[model samples]
Target chain A: MSYKAIQLIKRPSGDLTPDIFATVELPRPVLEEGQFLVRQTHMSLDPAMRTWLQEREDSYIEPVQVGEVMRSYGVGEVVESRNPDYPAGARVIGITGWAEYVLGNADMQVVDPAIDPEALLSVFYMTGLTAYVGLIRIGRPKAGETLVVSGAAGSVGSLVGQIAKAEGMRVVGIAGSDEKCRWLEEELGFDKAINYKSDNLGGQLDEACPNGIDLYYENTGGVIQPLVFERMNRFGRIVVCGMISEYNRDQPTPGPSWVDINLKALRVEGFVVVDHQDKAQEATEALAGYLQNGQLRFRTQVLEGLDSAIDGLSMLFRGDNTGKLLVRI
Target chain B: MSYKAIQLIKRPSGDLTPDIFATVELPRPVLEEGQFLVRQTHMSLDPAMRTWLQEREDSYIEPVQVGEVMRSYGVGEVVESRNPDYPAGARVIGITGWAEYVLGNADMQVVDPAIDPEALLSVFYMTGLTAYVGLIRIGRPKAGETLVVSGAAGSVGSLVGQIAKAEGMRVVGIAGSDEKCRWLEEELGFDKAINYKSDNLGGQLDEACPNGIDLYYENTGGVIQPLVFERMNRFGRIVVCGMISEYNRDQPTPGPSWVDINLKALRVEGFVVVDHQDKAQEATEALAGYLQNGQLRFRTQVLEGLDSAIDGLSMLFRGDNTGKLLVRI
Candidate 1:
């Protein structure tokens, strides 16, 4: 039997190109004892993937090596299992790759098959966990405090704004387009939304956050970063989640001056969701509770197949996707 | 009786000029029912004084208003008092101004007359507390960790390097002059000292911090900031104490990008000493313990009289002072 997988042939210079990834057909691996083979149904294409593609020595996770299947997170079904823990016909989710059939490791968790794969990948997985950890765990939002989230129309950012709203914070989202801004404000219950592409972003941000920003969830690192940073209140907490805007650039722009940071006593912190895996149970429960209460909402931009992931991943950097960018295998 | 005081006649445009301050004679304050008179003895000229002169509304404390006495922290002796709490001949340390004599506030703490005023200002007061809160409290240095301190010859930075060294961490100091670098290495016992003015700062930093920087005490924000920031290891902590180099510039330079911050999961926090006053007692005891153990050492460059403070304050911005700059009143 054979399966299809996309292998990283070359590293991107500045922007991703189709020639960098090659689709290949490989023979299915024979499952060893205590191991299983998973048929990946859906794979998430995230902004962090860009960093994984780079040849950085100090990244939190090891960079995906050349000639290897690109690393990703996804939901799948165990079709052939040699382990009792993950029997055949069981649904699981964890670290997967850009392949239709992948050999599952011990880290994959068996989940209920009845849950929608879109909802599973969008809400109950790394996406939701990232939003919860960055906004609730790191930002420490307080009732009535103002929160400004960049990339607000994206998966983690959209969830972050909603969670802040549920916590009684005045949530202001900054996104790429007016359509996405409307979706954030009207559909997701954000207090306000500003299109970063609009003129006078500083004035718009000031109008949106009249009390000044108290908790800033940073996703995109661009002009909006300095604009929001300058408006931060004393002792404001900045949760640096991702810098999608700067990932493709050869030289990222410098951030705001540290003088205000010292003068205002601000705390700027960055965290990766993998480091907080211990909080997964609590995060899942809280996120599920929010979902049950109708406080959490999400949208998915699904691609057709595995080969589409190469181009689909670039949608995140270009801000072309309105919600979670995923590829259905 | 009349005494001499320096008043802030105008705000500085960028670099502090002598004409901004005016020396004049003023009548000494009469002791009220609960108030006492303080005979200022040794006033500390700090880098933060430059910030207090700015007309910034978002500052942690109120700016020193034009036509008012320049704000400072100094050691004084209680010459006369109506309040029994502060009796005659009690030496105290607290917030004072650029004057020969002034009314003491209730916040002033009485210190033992036997302790040197330089030791009090350099180790036990705001300087020591700042170093403690930033390094011990915020940075949370672990043994065998590598620390890089900018402005390593300044009051707070010097103490920070020593404290980290006492905690069994390798400390690297960054200063402007080679002499300051030698003093930090030979006298203060720093593991390595890099002259920021020398060519190939990046090469020197890479050589100094072979293990990569884990704890960064930021006192002077300039070229050294970006160089050290790029060398930060995973989960590094940056303590933004002061930006002396940027204080005098009309437009302070922007900091490094947050891309690495997210990738490395670093924490960059800024704090003002006044905000952490609740930790004063514990800090004083710890600092005193270090002092008695010979782990802490400090030097003071004392100016002659009150009028000299107008120009002495500029020494901090120019990196001209070797250690804690003070004025003997």
Candidate 2:
């Protein structure tokens, strides 16, 4: 059997265009001992994808080289296996690259959804884990404290605000669109939402969080950060999950003078979720509980077909998507 | 008896002129029960004194009001006593206004000379405690880590760099003059010293601390800070002790950008020495041990008489003093 996949054919200059990626066909590898093949079901299209696409010097996790299969994390089902770790029929989650079928060693640990069928997608692994670690673990939101999450309506930031609200914190989200802002406050129970594009960001933020922000889950870093830094209270902590705002810019745009950081005494830490692998299971379990209890809700903007990965990723850079965008294969 | 005293007649505008302070005569304070009179011996002149002189809308502490006897920390010997806590002829170190004599409560703590005589003037209380707490307790310098101290030849910065070097970490010092920088490297055993006035600060910093700054003792703010922030390693801790460079400036100068903090992920905290009073005795004793063992040395530039207090303090603002500035009355 042969599998179709999207591969990186060219590196991008400023923004990712359709010509940057090329789709190709290849014969599927035969499963060896302790090896399995998986048919990709759902692949995450995150703002971080845009960062990886850039062939520049940044804090990105290495750029996608030309002629290589595009890298991604996906949920897939095992189609064939000659391994003891996974059977021929099982659902698994791992770094299944941008392809319809994936061949990997069975030793790559995966969660079997057979035992607990109701383990929702939000709890499956990465999505929920990113939310859990980014909030309770990194942000350390305390009850009655104010939490301002940028990109608040997106996958990681959305769950971050919801979890902060659950912790009894006053959650304020900043999204690009008025609709996303409304959804955050009205549906997600965020205390308030400020549309970063239309609203007076600094003024609205001050009004929304009168006590000053305690924890800032920073997913967007650019002009918004200076505004947030100015109003931060003493001992405020910022967790840098991603900086989607600076991904597509052509020139090196310097961030504004936030000298208020030293004046206010703030702790800003940058973290990647993959570094916290030890707590992956615990994070997934807790987030799943929230999902089952209907305490948390997220929207998945599903883009059909594996070929749409590039366009789906571009949605993040353009700030078009309202939630966790997934390319359904 | 009457004693001559200097009162803060007015807050100085841009510079400290003679009119800013007024010499006054006050009836010597009577020794009540549990109180003693001490003839002032030495007064410590600090940059914090000038900071207290400025009027701030949101002042951290109340500014020294007009017509008030200036507050200072001094060493004196009790001449008369009516209290059991302190006997006549005992040496004490405590808060004493800028006066020839002071009548203080018997509750005033006695300085233990034998514990370590170096501490009585150098290591026991303010400057010593500032260095001890700011370097050990606050900055938390580790072995093999690079520690950078701005204003390195000054009172607190000098001790911090020396202490960091003693802890097996490489130490770099940034002082105002070539003479001071040379003294820091030669007399204090600092690994590297750069004259902020003569050398390119950013270039010198990069060359001196090639591994990058892990712990920064931030004393000089404004232009120096942005340069320091750029070279700081990830998870670097910055202990904001004082901003002497910007303290005397009349206008509100802009500080470093939040991008410097956001990208590097630094922890910047400002701490008052009084807040860490609980550990003062322990830190003082340890620092005294190092002094007695010839592991630590404190340099002082002493000017004689109460009238020289203003001049001694002026040396701090001008960055003329190489070590702790003291007024020997």
DockQ of each: 0.89, 0.32
lDDT at A59, model 2: 42
TM-score of model 2 vs. true structure? 0.87
TM-score of model number 1, chain B: 0.98
Model 2: reference contacts kept, as a fraction: 0.23
lDDT of each structure?
A: 0.93, 0.77
> What tens-digit string does per-residue lDDT give for candidate 1 at A188-241?
999899999899998999899999999999999888999899999999999999
Which pairs of residues have clashing backbones in candidate 2?
Answer: A257-B257, A258-B257, A258-B258
| Clash pairs detected, candidate 1 | none
- Candidate No. with top DockQ: 1
Q: A1-329 in candidate 2: lDDT tens per residue?
A: 68899898887877778898889998999777778888888887766676667664324257778898998888777888887677777777777789999886533456656633223344446667877887887677889999999989888888888888778999999998989989998899999999888757788887999998888888887667778876777668878777777666665455433333434445566666666679977986787677777878878788899988878888888889978788888
lDDT (10s digit) by residue, model 2, range B1-329: 79988899888877677778888889987666677898888888877788778776434557788988888888888889887677787888887878889888533678754443224656568888888888888788899999988888888888888888888999998888889988988988999998777657888888888898899898777567778877888668888888777766665465544433444455566666755679977997788678777878778888877888766677888888868888888
Best by TM-score: 1
For candidate 2, the per-residue lDDT at B215 reads 91
Question: How accurate locally is residue B271 in candidate 1, as Cα lDDT from 0 to 100?
Answer: 94
How much DockQ does model 2 earn?
A: 0.32
